[model samples]
Target: MKQKIESKIQVKWKACNHGLKPQACQHWLKIYFADKKVDELEKAISKAARDPAKYGIDQPALERRFKWTRTTMTQVVEYTLQAVVGTA
Candidate 1:
């Protein structure tokens, strides 16, 4: 299930007009999640993403990158949560 969600995010990202690879997305998710559980990460990002300013300058791009069904957000959220939880 986790793989499915993450894969969806990857797929959405690949469909973007992005010049760089999707690694940046993964990297950012890692940094953002740093110390949270999978579910927690999802909850965190989903909530925080409500505010563009909080997310910062790359907002437009990142927001578009995550454009898609629940899958993209699911991936972003889950990955972040897992990374955070792992660190903790």
Candidate 2:
């Protein structure tokens, strides 16, 4: 199921006129994260946001890549989780 979703995202991404813009990326990310299997990962990420060291998450690297502070990133993760779970 995951593979099928990934393939579909990839195909749609390739066919997207806007290329890899943020909107396109976010659309795909929402679709991918909506999978039931991703629920576990989202929960782990939410926990990792609170305790990066315990989760082996490189906070600085993620901050650099996202250009967001840990707090902002945490909120983003939580929001995404809620959206995916249909609770938002």
Candidate 3:
């Protein structure tokens, strides 16, 4: 499955290299990173959610720093999780 996805991405990248599929190439690449961020956020939240961690330090810190709500953070994580895991 991983190989198949990589193969598809390689095809898209090759098209970008030829300068013919700019929009499709850019869109998939952007989605790839966005999905990656979701996995990362999930890991961070898992770590902070452990014992001796009542303070808001992980994803919450990022949320506070960025001036967003806890709801938005969870929503983004859910979106990313569905994008990555759902596709698989």
Candidate 4:
């Protein structure tokens, strides 16, 4: 399913280098690293992806904030983190 980024998140995320255009969660995530603290956002995304049910975070909210396809969103996010932090 196609998801859209929320206005609130978009405004908050616009500082990143991606220019706030439409993107998947993974793509949008790259911007975080480019403009802001990658590590901090990585942790937040990690927590959000792993056990999102327990986190009480809205998938739709994330989808809106990212416009990503749910299936690979977490995988790409984690993969990006691993690549940056170094995959062991």
Candidate number with the higher lDDT (2 or 3): 3
Q: Show the lowest summed lDDT stretch of 10 residues, model 4.
A: 1-10
Ranked by TM-score, the better of candidates 1 and 3 is: 3
| Number of the top lDDT candidate | 3
Higher lDDT: candidate 1 or 2?
2
Against the hidden reference, what TM-scores do the models get? 0.26, 0.29, 0.47, 0.28
TM accuracy, model 4: 0.28
List candidate 4 stretches off by more than 4 Å: 1-39, 67-88
Could you tell me the C-alpha RMSD of candidate 4 in Å?
13.9
- Runs with alpha carbons beyond 4 Å of true place in candidate 1: 1-69
| Preferred candidate (TM-score higher): 1 or 2 | 2
Comparing 2 with 3 on TM-score, the higher-scoring candidate is 3
lDDT of 2 at 59: 77
Give the poorly placed runs of model 2, Cα more than 4 Å off: 18-26, 33-88
Residues 14-61 of candidate 4 have per-residue lDDT tens digits of 534454344543454664444345345555766786787887877777
Whole-model lDDT values for every prediction: 0.53, 0.55, 0.56, 0.49
Which has the better TM-score: candidate 2, or candidate 4? Answer: 2
Sort by TM-score, best first: what order?
Answer: 3, 2, 4, 1
Over 1-88, each residue of candidate 3 has an lDDT whose tens digit, in order, gives 5355546555666677787467766765865565456556656655655732575467566545444434555565555455445533
List runs of model 3 lying over 4 Å from the truth: 1-7, 52-54, 57-88
